[model samples]
Target: MKRKWKFFIGGLVVVAALGYLGYQGFIASAAYQYELGEYLAQPGIDASQNVQVAGQVATGSIEQKSFDLKFTMTDGVNNMVVVYQGTVPDSFRAGGEVVVAGRRDPASGVFEATQVMPKCASKYVAE
Candidate 1:
């Protein structure tokens, strides 16, 4: 009877630990997606809030610095400089589609990226 009780308690603890870890991970990785046009049009977006915005990198806008990277992302009509402090993706370059996840500073008007996800076309066009 004592052995059964100990096993039951241990199993319950392991399940609870797993559940808590999953919940924390979900919270930390939550992001909202917005197209470049839609995000630029919204004037009411709060700078303090985290968001994920997708756009193509503007030509001749990439500049690498010692500690950070800077570039302009545009939807053709409007563009904003993004400051990223993470390793850039190999597929990321000028004219490539990318999704940046982070918060924007109201004062600087620069998007501070936590993660930069580069997108590529799955299928190539036939010549």
Candidate 2:
């Protein structure tokens, strides 16, 4: 009886330890959300921070070279160039609201986007 209790308690401890580690990992890896203006205004952001910057894609700022996508995101006041290395979504276009997720390139002063999520403005049409 005592041996069975010992085994059960050990299993619970292992499970709890795994759960704690998983939670910590998730928190560390989660993307920090910021507006384009706020992100650029920061004196210096943590280089290791995984960030999601939300803004409107500036007009006439998109340039496509093969699968590479480069565009400027603006908060109607401040702007920053975002360089993404993948095909953008079908909803992606100039003047569209988008959230780019990635870390800033300390060398080039550009946000290196890993993902571009376009928030379509006209998806809902009231019938």
Candidate 3:
């Protein structure tokens, strides 16, 4: 009886280990990070799929409205237009570094940003 119990416990451990490995593999295949240039270069990236794009806001390209905003993002060469319909981040500004999370609109050639994060300015640090 003791031997049977030990074998059962070992089997349970092995099953748990396999389950963990499968979970890790699934997560590894799900998401990834890429800069704006690399993301654009990838062929057949589904425009409807959510993604994060990092780049600097183009200088003199930010247009603000009462409840909407339009801006251009650039990784020095490639540029992507971003449209956001929500409140802008505190660090948002022209020529500032930012990461926009959203899906691309293939027809309009714009990224509809659902979330935006701005890189803090180096020159202005809190004391």
Candidate 4:
């Protein structure tokens, strides 16, 4: 009876530890999504926190050099410069909608993007 109780207690401890680790991992991996204006309006935003900002690509703002890309994203009222080093998506273009994920540089106020996802237009047509 004592042995069984000890084993059960050990199992419970293991389960509790696993649950705690899982929760921490989820919190660390989660990125907050924000609109361009909303994000820019926040006071003292944490530069180290990973975030996703959605905005429209500003016309005549895109500058590409091989794999490096730089552009300005706008929410009509606010604008932010985003620098990304990766393959540009085919759907990405001036005036197109895009979601950029990464951390913001505190010194230069530029968003250093790890991923750039362009919003694709709907292919379906209604009669």
The model with the greatest TM-score is 4
Candidate 4 per-residue lDDT, tens place, 91-110, comes to 89999999999999988999
Each prediction's TM-score versus the true structure: 0.73, 0.82, 0.70, 0.85
Q: Where does candidate 4 stray beyond 4 Å?
A: 122-127
Model 1 misplaced regions, further than 4 Å: 1-28, 125-127
Q: Which wins on lDDT, candidate 3 or candidate 4?
A: 4
Ranking, TM-score, top scorer first: 4, 2, 1, 3
- Candidate 3 root-mean-square deviation in Å: 4.9
lDDT of prediction 4: 0.94
RMSD of each: 3.4, 2.5, 4.9, 2.3
Greater TM-score among 3 and 4 belongs to: 4
lDDT (Cα, tens digit) per residue for candidate 1, span 46-79: 7766789999999999998765899999999989
lDDT of each: 0.89, 0.92, 0.86, 0.94
Instruction: Name the 10 consecutive residues with the lowest summed lDDT in model 1.
Output: 40-49
Model 2 / residue 48 / CA error / Å: 1.4
Best by lDDT: 4
